[model samples]
Target: MTGTDAKDDLHQYLREAREALLWKLDGLSEYDLRRPLTPTGTNLLGLIKHVASVTAGYFGAVFDRPFPEPMPWIESGRDENDDMWATAEESREQIIGLYHRAWAHADETIEALPLDATGRVPWWPAERGGMTLHRILCHMLSEIARHAGHADIVRELIDGSAGRRPDNTNIPPLNEQWWLDYHDRLDRTARATRA
Candidate 1:
């Protein structure tokens, strides 16, 4: 494949992961969006919020194209892991808006620069701070995909919803009883391991 093709494929995958993460929030109430469904306080809105900040930094600051707005939660360190979740005052529109803007900024950077264009990551060790657009893209893609998986689990815990995205469930279309029996078989196998 050509260099451009590789970049496009990577960008497309990143975009899908970003959309999948955001899609998990649809039709949910504010309480449900912010409510921690996992033991580590993982929630739908928080996942989006955290990704926005990280995405902006990697695609914005890393490439010398800064995001237009200030992210005090990430920049100022006002609260620990503030980016990991949304605050009561932060509306759904606001966080989602920021994420969209970050995507635009990242896209511009990706478009303007070549795959080998060098950039420094300030957060990384001095010896390994320098990186290329391709490397950063791969890293961010992995990061977003991992968080998207987390969003999947958190959403499932909230309302028994499970899928790759809203339009694509990507799972076998089986009856409810089939799922329950499959789950039971897995449970029994897990128990048998310790017996």
Candidate 2:
């Protein structure tokens, strides 16, 4: 792909991944959002909260602009893991709303800078000599895709739902007997391995 085309592709991929991450949270109740779905305490709302911090930090604070609001615990060193798991102080609506706003702010940064425009990352000065807008955009896209994959697994565990995106409708319905057959296959695999 040409330079411009590749840049456009990166931006499009980022938007798609971010949307998929948010879509995974749809139709979930507050309790469902906060419920730990993995051994490590990853949950739907927690994923959204992390995205908000990363988005605002990388795109807003990195650029010397103001983020919309404070992440109290993150700012105060209450719990580092709070970034990836919901806390009692955080609400599903508040985190998700902040995430949406962060996206808008991040989009504006992407729009204002050309792919080759450079920025200084103060925290990573020793590692990254300087960073291009293209690099940051690509990195954010990968970050979103990574967390979205986590969201996909957690969502499926919650309600047996799995798909590439929210609008996906291509999954074939399975009957109870089909599930039994699938389980039987799994049992056979376990037995063979145990033996």
Candidate 3:
């Protein structure tokens, strides 16, 4: 109903997405967390790392408040895809820590600015680069939530564990056989449509 209410709502959703993205790494070995599950090399830890980098940018540099640390992987002429995966030397705690710090920094920015506060996205064209805090919040919520969904699928592929969150799986409470049968039915239907 009010500006503060809207901001709070957006913040809540963004926080949930961030948590869900991080939860995918729970109970995974280092190999499993970093192993590429998709053709493009999507992995749980990498997803967390990518989101951390993204959040730091949108909520950090975009708002004239750069993340306090230098991210060499994202700076200079580094490979654009370099931030999407973790190096063997990068511990899971490090990536997750970055994400958490990004969250705190981003939160500070959001709380410090009004919804109408303005900033420019350095990467965007000048004509469309101007943005309000509310706009950035919406953009970030969409971006983070999309990656959280990717984490969900990657986690499923890794261990057959499916859920939006640990507590609320958001899937049917059906038995394993039911799920298998459901998968078979979908497979049959998809194959039939190929004719």
lDDT of 3: 0.91
Writing each residue's lDDT as its tens digit, candidate 1 over 10-47 gives 99999999988888999999999999987889999999
Return the TM-score for candidate 3, rounded to 2 decimals: 0.98
Sliding window of 10 residues with minimal summed lDDT for model 3? 67-76
Q: Which has the greatest TM-score?
A: 3
**Model 1: lDDT of residue 79:** 75
Ranking the candidates on lDDT from highest down gives 1, 3, 2
Of candidates 3 and 2, the better by lDDT: 3
Could you tell me every candidate's TM-score relative to the true structure? Answer: 0.97, 0.86, 0.98
Tens-place lDDT per residue, model 3, 21-135, is: 8888999999999999899999888888889998999998888999997788887799878889999999999999999999999999999998999999998999999999999
Superposition error at 21 for model 3 (Å): 0.6
lDDT of 1: 0.92
TM-score of 2: 0.86
If both were scored by TM-score, which would come out higher, candidate 1 or candidate 3? 3
